[model samples]
Target: MDRSPFPHHGPLRPEQVTGRESLAVDLAQRIADRRLTALVGPRRFGKTSLLKRVAADLAAVGPQPVWIDLYQLTSMADFAAAVDRGLASVVGPVRRALDSIAATVALRIGVLGVELTRSPKYRPDPVLSLRNLLGVLTSAAQRHDLFVVFDEFSGVANIQGGAGVLRTELQHHFQSLGIVFAGSEPSTMRALFSEQTQPFFAQADLVEIGPLSDAAVGHIVEDGFETTQRHTGGITSRIVAFAAGHPQRAMQLADALWRRVEPGETADMPAWEAALAEVRTNVNAASERIFSLLPTGQQKTLRAIAAGGSIYGAAASALELPPGSAQDAAEKLIGNGIVRRAQERLEVIDPLLADWLCRRFPI
Candidate 1:
């Protein structure tokens, strides 16, 4: 059985990944210098894959990577558990250091073998367990570089004082550890790091990841088909044009097209159409949910942006929207990471969402 070359799910390794060479190099360099970095991007923008690439680069020389996903953590205990999961990868002196802390916190080695626990006495300390866990890692970092990456870090806001605890701990550990904080929600991440009143205000350097370049998108589509011994039949250009450099969309379309074409078969326009239909079907629910949750003005603005070309002018007029309303809504969407301005024209950042809007409502 010939498997699909495009992987749209989970993190891709450094060698298997494409379109982020410069970013990976720069990120690794910064982290190697013991800089605290904040990686900000929209959801499904391949931040994890890029992080993996950076980790791999740093690993070859030094720096052990500890990765934690904070996405559904609702409390400080949950945060402590997630930290433990990341620390499970640590070994040698660092592992011993964690073990020492584990004893003090009455950390139990459960049947599951997860060693992160908070003692009853310290449970009232809010995120003190987390602070202890990080303290161990940072102390270990004084000898060996520890690259700590917290993905979906905006969830820190969910815990009562998780952000405050993290900020205070990080201030003392800056010179000792290399840290990278990443989150999918641009609005929340901005508030966490950019707002002066927020605990993480001005704590780390900001790095923004956007859509892939056209050449990178082309490379993925073309290389996948060629490596599988399947001909692209000039459909690569069409896929590239539609994907507009969104990594997930490019891989999704490529995967769909690869499935449509048999071994030794060439991909054609019909294959492209079928693949697009499949993708649209899969994403319709999400697109609908996003659209339904938006305010009236923003919904109209999305439609206008999807229609393309002068969203505040002709598109707004065609959508029966006042220019001021459309402009204001567009600005709000941009701020929320839903839309972006490219070459003086506003565009829906998610290509599939824009495609859904175009198909469901012409204009």
Candidate 2:
């Protein structure tokens, strides 16, 4: 393909996706066993790309798989329409039933969109429509071993009573179909399935997507540069380190660097600095906004973590945070998706972000 191996513009194409062999095997196993699985992580960490890749893999084999992006849904009608569209390819009674429901549901759109009209004998309320939709979807999958993937599932939680409604709908007969839910928001995704009083508590297996290895990302960047005949001594690894193992950031920084150098030329400090500056320009505003919203304690904790200090025990003293507040701050940061538990200590999720914070509020 005539594209950067390290993608920056958008989600990676199937051919460009790399370094996910182990994750793919685990996902395939879960699908084969028909277990409800969730892929959870911070935003921009390639969760959607991975979900697409896995869904595409299964669809290529046999049983048809349907992918619904919940981010685009607004009302219950949108939800019902999504499920109906997904099962349109099924044959016989289930397909007919889904068609009937679609025909009955009152939905309309016009230019800026073409007009769509449907008429049927009976129409159900939004709540019952959702319940019935799941019922028919399960029926459709039973006749054909189906895989249904809900991407950006975290968006559903934003709708009023959405979690409860979904839990009720799928409680009875979802086991027949292989389902995977993918979301970028870690805290909300965890709460949906982990809270004891919640409807889906302990229902799906949680797959936490951690940061990529510096080595893997570094290799990808180095290879991309070399493919373009642009050489780099250690600028590539530095980019990986600055991105803090986040795949998208690493790829993005690498892609930006590639553009600054010409073919058959070496990428020196000037090219590296220019690339880094571009990343800073693009990411600084958002990083600053996120940092500004934190309270004094969290801001202190963030600075400590961003500065790469041992933020667990005695290191709290370095942050000038009172004893035990560091832990609380760490928890808050984790909940906010600003940082996560690494091998032993907590680390900021985005290295470039850490640099931004460090430069903003020097500790």
Candidate 3:
């Protein structure tokens, strides 16, 4: 059997990743130069994959990569544990120091290689533990740079004084550490870094990740099919057009297309349609759940935008909504990262969700 060319889940390999090469290279170089960066983008837009590429590029010559994912963390204890976990995963000098410190504290490191076990009588303040760990790691940075990537860094908002704790601890290490704070929630991320009252205000440079180019998506599609002895038969362009440069969606459509054709078979019009049907079927339940969670006004606004109807024009009137309400709904959608302004037109950020909207509520 031929190896599958498309990855269905998780971050793509650093070399296998496409469309974000230049951006990744630039980010890696900046981090090596000891710059703090805030990387923001929509969920599943390959932000993690880009970070992985950055990590790979910096591995041999620059700081050691320490990845800490803060998604769904509920307290400072969880945050400290996450940091400990990330540190435990590192090799070389950092890992050896962690082992020695864990022994001294009566704690255990390298349990299952990624888990840190706390001693019953040796509980320390979570915030203090986090600060001490950073102190140790950043101290080591004087000898070997430490590049830290905090994925879903905005989730820290859920922990009381989380941002303050991080800011106070990390500020002192600016000269020695390279940090990239990344999150998928655009509005929350903006509030954390851009708002004057926020603790991280002016702390890091901002970088926004957008969709991949259509040409790049097409290249991935063609390469995947041709390498597997299957021909696209001119269907690659249609797949690219529908995917609208979304990194995951492009690979998803290509995978669906690949499943429809056998070795040496050409994917013609019928095969393309069948693949689309399959893709739609796979995402139907998810789309419905997302649509059901929206407010009525947002639902109406989404349908109008998906159908290419004016949100605050006759479409709003027909939906029995005032122009202002439509505008508010559109803005809310944009803030939530569900809809975006593309070329001065409102477009749904998720092309699959947009397709579901139009199909579920026809114009």
* Alpha carbon deviation, residue 218, candidate 1 (Å): 1.0
- What is candidate 1's TM-score against the reference? 0.90
Q: Model 1: C-alpha RMSD to truth?
A: 2.8
Give lDDT tens digits, candidate 3, residues 1-363: 787787768888988888888888879877877788999888789999999888987886656798888888887877878777777778888677666666665555434222323552555667777776666566656667677899989889889888898888888888788899999877888889989999999888999899999899989989998989999999999989999988898888898889888999999999889889999999999999998999999998888999988887688998778999999999888878888888889999899999999899986
Model 2 lDDT, residue 241, Cα: 68
**Local error of candidate 1 at residue 328 (angstroms):** 3.7
lDDT of candidate 2 over 1-363, digit per residue (tens): 245556766577765666787887798779878888999888878777877777678767765566667775666655655554555544554456455544454422111011111332334355565665666666556566677888888777766676677777666656777888888777888888899977778999999777777777877787888877778767876887677778888888888888877777788898888888988999999898888889989988888888878766677886788768878888888987889888887788888788898888775
List the candidate 3 regions with Cα displacement exceeding 4 Å.
Answer: 98-124
Any idea what lDDT model 3 has?
0.83
lDDT score at residue 18, model 1, on the 0-100 scale: 82
Top model number, lDDT: 3
Task: Summarize candidate 1's per-residue lDDT along 1-363 as a digit string, tens digits.
Answer: 887899888777677788988888888888888787889887778999999888877877778788878987787877877776777766766567666656676653121123334464534343655776777666667766677899989888788878887778778877778889998877778888889988888878889988899999998888888999998999999888988888888899999999999889999988999999999999999999999999999998888778775755567787688988888888889877888777777889889999999999884
Who wins the TM-score comparison?
A: 3
TM agreement with the true structure for every prediction: 0.90, 0.85, 0.93
Q: How does candidate 2 score on lDDT?
A: 0.74
